[model samples]
Target: MEPIVILTLLAAMIILLLILGAPFKSFKWIGTGAVRLLIGALFLFFLNTFGGIFEYHLPINLFTASVSGFLGVPGIVALIFLDMMVVN
Candidate 1:
């Protein structure tokens, strides 16, 4: 399948999750809006490189560490997933 198609599907899935409000509570610490997204992207990047792949893959410290004081998880998840798709 084309990369674009895969991306579209991924986007659709994320949107569906948002609409369904599935376990978003875990992400509440992320705060609200674009700032959260920006941080998530930075976090996702540093997480893998600075902390290593295992660290990034695991959630032991991700929730507390990534949230950075407070909004939503989608922005973070979106940033991470978007970078993953684009980078790899």
Candidate 2:
């Protein structure tokens, strides 16, 4: 019932589902996008502090948003990776 316990359980479930390649939809592309969206939203909302503690905001900001608008999804991925590594 604790938040940490719930998060651990959810994370474990996702790991299991991914490893098993459990298809969530009949469509492959849609299913993959749905999974990524769910996982990203979960982490972004709950774990923003993990990135924030280091003043490491994802390039989801103004500058990168412009780049993202031009470069699309790959740009966002680069932003995410940069944010993740900023603290390390």
TM-score of each: 0.28, 0.38
The residue-level lDDT of candidate 2 at 25 comes to 47
Q: Which candidate comes out best when scored by lDDT? A: 2
Give a tens-digit lDDT track for model 2, residues 1-88.
6757756875776676577663554666654544564455445435345767866555233455444544556755666777568744
Residue 22 lDDT in candidate 1: 34
lDDT at 36, model 1 = 42
lDDT of 1 by residue, 1-88 (tens): 7645644664565465456543476664432332344344444444555557454542324453345314445545564575568666
| Alpha-carbon shift of residue 8 in model 2 (angstroms) | 1.4
Whole-model lDDT per candidate: 0.47, 0.56
Best by TM-score: 2
Residue 68 displacement (Å), model 2:
12
